[model samples]
Target chain A: MAEPTPSLAPARPPTGPRVWNNPRARAIIYQVLVLGGVIGAAAYLIDNTLTNLAERSIRSGFSFIWHEAGFAISEALIDYQPNHSYVRAFIAGLLNTLKVGLLGIVLVTILGIIIGIARLSTNWLVARLASVYVETFRNVPLLLQLYLWYSLLTEMLPGGRDALSLFTAFYLNKSGLMYPVPVYDGIHPFMIVAFLIGCVGAYAWGRYATRRHEATGVPTPRFWPSVGFVLGLPLVVWLIGGAPTAIDVPQMERFRFVGGWHVSIEFIALLLGLVVYTGAFVAETVRAGILSVSRGQTEAALSLGLRRGLVLRLVLLPQALRVIMPPLTSQYLNLMKNSSLAVAIGYPDLVAVANTTLNQTGQAIEAIAVIMAVYLTISLAISGFMNWYNKRVALVER
Target chain B: MINLAERRAASGPVIQMAGVNKWYGEFHVLKNINLEVRSGERVVVCGPSGSGKSTMIRCINRLEEHQKGRIVVDGIELIADLKQIDAVRREIGMVFQHFNLFPHMTVLENLTLAPMWVRNTPRKEAEDAAMAYLERVKIPEQAHKFPGQLSGGQQQRVAIARSLCMKPKIMLFDEPTSALDPEMIKEVLDVMIELAQGGMTMICVTHEMGFARTVADSMVFMDGGEIVEKAPPTEFFKNPKSERTKLFLSQILH
Candidate 1:
């Protein structure tokens, strides 16, 4: 060891010789430099893009979105004239996307949960069938599946006079699936009010039944009463108010059927493809989540004398959902993003309509930005909702 | 119902197993095991690993199906009948090795679950019973806490309290103290000993010979899917009848 320094001199601080040499200071400096580099790179790209747009004499902004879009969408949920603004077309397209995405989420979750449980069934045939379904749908590319469904609906189904008619109100043909629309004359609002009241009454009834069940051992059946609440009240009110609702059956008049609600083949193809494809991955996620809980949980619950159904409802599902929710949120987000593939099947989703706007207006950057912004908003919304749900079901692992 | 109550109150054996055999696929896990546990008797079963000690007790609650056996609990015979299985399970409470408390529920909720759902006890009544049991197990302060928040010993005690809330006639403990830390084992064993002193019929599968000696009315030594020797704890420890029991006792005690 070196000789000790003179005691009179100021004692050297324990840390380091300089601020630059200090670990905490160095870490801050390194992060600042990385942040600067990232900002500089982003600034450069933005500048380059601006300069290129100027050189090409292309106006880049959302101003042109208000211009008229002359192109017509084959299928629209809202009324759209060809003379309507591109903004209107974009709104319709966005609604289409939301419609399909929401429906797909619901259908896929049901299908996935059913298949997931069936795969774990003791019945060999049911398990095998679910396995076969999962393998078949998951292995095929979604785009290819969409194409196949599109062709099948367009080509396989007979056209015109040979249209397959279900009862007198529904028709299936090359055009699309058509179903009867109820045309309400007067007193529609009263019927709607009655329906709403029935729903609230039914909810109160359920709460009362649950309370009664807890107080006594007698369980009140909820299904038939719920059905009556939904359908019976509305029907009763309609009859009392001079039943003004009439079914508008579609009439086959030569080329196409008239006066009915129609779902286009493109919409059908996109929906089927998205739901069936995403459902397989969801099924696997569900299975893994349920399996992650140890078998002892069920044994303990059953041994405590709970019924089989009660054991599953109280013990298995709560634990399983804790493991299921986080990954299930990601699967939902993926499904929403995958809906951008609608362009391949001629479905007028946001991307498809935005592409048309870009081609017509020559405002490529703005169009692309709009599409990105909408997708980002939708993704954030879905994740936000799911995060709340996940927190509610999360284990209290204090 | 009157006859059934009369039979149950006659003070015969609460649990009986005769010529019980079980197999997992092709491997025989339990072989021709015969055992009996009377009312309010504490039977401690000790065995080496894979000796079918847990399996034999599990058969009493029908957690594991015995392929060939005449197992009966509380005057009702165990069979493939779902109704009878549920009835027997309702009367017999079990505690697992890992303290398999429902992690999602609070300690009080876990205790009240079976009482409310199975026994149809009202909420206030179930909660009252649960709090009483929690006090008995000496963890009433942690009644609202989740299982994960408690130590291993505390969770095991909560599990025992949960079982007692059901008012079970017979309790089966499958290695209750096996999963606890060394210091924590004493607390759990203390609770179990208190439970024993209160005249609750209990069949415990464990290696805690000291505990067995303290509370067990009879000690059973099992080896390789069969009971080798069984006697009062003092006699069993002093003079084990079988060579395997002697070897096991030497290895464990030394």
Candidate 2:
């Protein structure tokens, strides 16, 4: 390792290794090769698919979406006919999927929180019951649960002729469940306006009460006032606006129910399955979240003379929600995706409609792509909202 | 509740325990303990870990139930009755070794919580009281900061402030300075000394013999689940009676 002359220093000898043998250069070269390989594979696959489609004379584009879908759906939230375009059918299917997903999320969240708290109850029997529920539903296969619920709803219930009537306004049969639909004919706008005004007033009063309590020691009636504003104001406005009072009760005709708010049996089965299955995972997540909080927190709250309920509401829940939310968001996404299982029970959700389109048109690639796109869009939207919520609740640690 | 002057004139003990025994699944933790702390008296309880000093003070507020005992705080006996337990707990303030201040709350919020919720004090009043206590601990500027952002000494002072906001008749400190750094211990100890000078009834479990010398009216020494000796700090340090007390003092003082 002798030093080179000044004149030759610019062209120094290789002290360590050649450029190709250098670790950094080798790593870059390897990464480039991997990237090229992936690109080449994708390009080849795309080319092969195009050539095969051309050979079979099967047009490959989304233009088929505009074609009429000549198939009747059992349950349609919006107006639909066999002559309706595939796009319309897709929209209807997407709406149904969203309906189940939204409702399941709400129901599962409530059930999960209750069961989670019950699992930690001081009462032995309550705790044991919650444990049994979580274990039972969580262990069973979700698809099997859907099948069982569907059978229970359709096979066990009587036909529409002998519908099980409840309070003479609601009826349940093998076809579906139905209940009275409220008709506000001409006074709808006034009632809605009154309800909105009441909501704003109630919110203002709540803020004022909180501020007054902070300034003085007097506690205001918060809960009852909120209830009154939300319910009473709307009722009063309906009466003042000449309450329509033309409720349409479910009427059982020869073979089916007519003129009422009806929920299809397929929708009910899917909802029950999604709620029961996803709820178990959510319960476990809730339990884990609560348990992650140290015992010292509870003892500290209790020692401060906070009652058990207040301790739970203030100290326990705020902390546990931070832990519960991130995982709970994933569970919600899982529920939304699992709603696709409705296809197995003849429910006209997004996936079920897509499958029908694929079978009729022999457009496997197009149909699969649409299905993936819909699911992907939904999942991303859910994740975006969840991430925002997660950021708000995360602990501000130094 | 009697006025402070009348209650002081009565000379009744703020805390009393007789034949107090506790067990953790047949493992006897506290045995045949008898103690009394009068109003405005500062008692220091010191022993090695597991000697039941912390457990005994915890029993004062019913944080730990004594299986066999009549533990009374401010005339409210410790029992399974929720009302009695709540009453006793309301009148007592507690500090922990880890400075178990709520991490989610600011120093001011931690101090004001019990005053507002338990005492039904107005939020404005609770905040003012919290600020006063924070100033007394000499860290009023840290009120808006969360516990996690504060140093160990500062957090401990905030815990002290939180306890004081309850306007408690008695304060219990479970190794308040044990978890602090060597340099930070004096800061917390200084706050404790100020509290003692203010005539707060305090039962502290600490190994800081210097703090004991400065603020303790009486020192209670325990070993093997029994109080080996109890006497005024002057007499206990100079004229320890039991061999266990002598041994404990020798080891800890060194």
Q: Which candidate is the best by lDDT?
A: 1
* Clashing residue pairs in candidate 1 (N, C-alpha, C atoms within 3 angstroms): none
- The C-alpha lDDT values of all candidates are 0.89, 0.88
Query: Could you tell me the TM-score of chain B in model 2?
Result: 0.95
Q: Go through the candidates in order and give each one's DockQ.
A: 0.63, 0.58
Q: Give candidate 1's total backbone clashes.
A: 0
Candidate 2 C-alpha lDDT tens digits along A1-398? 99886674465565877879889999999999999999999999999999999999987888999999999888889999999999999989999999999999999999998998899899999999999999999999999999999999899998867888999889888888898987647787877888898899899889988788677766566888888887788899888877778888887778777888989889999999999989889989999999998988888777888788778866778888889989999999999999999999999999999999999888889999988999999999998999999888777655
Question: Mind giving the per-residue lDDT tens digits that candidate 1 earns over A1-398?
Answer: 99997689777777647888889999999999999999999999999999999999889888887888999987788999889999999999999999899999999899989999889889999999999999999999988998999898889998876889889788888877889977866777878888999898889889987788667745566768987997789899889978776888888887778887888878888899899999998998888888988999999998999989889888999999988888888888888888999999899999999999999989888899989999999999999999999999898866
User: How displaced is residue A171 in candidate 2, in Å?
Assistant: 3.1
Taking chain A by itself, what TM-score does each prediction score? Answer: 0.89, 0.90
Q: What does candidate 1's lDDT look like per residue over B1-254, in tens digits? A: 22434543667898999999999999899888888887887899998999999999999999999999799899999988989999999999999999899999999889988988888887778888899999998999998898999999999999999888889999999999989899999999999999988888999999998999998889988888888887989999998888998889999997
Q: Estimate each model's TM-score.
A: 0.91, 0.90
Off by over 4 Å in 1: A1-20, A185-195, A198-232, A242-245, B1-10
The clash numbers for all candidates, in the given order, read 0, 0
Regions of model 2 farther than 4 Å from truth: A1-17, A20-31, A188-203, A217-221, A243-245, B1-10, B19-28, B79-84, B120-125, B223-228, B242-247
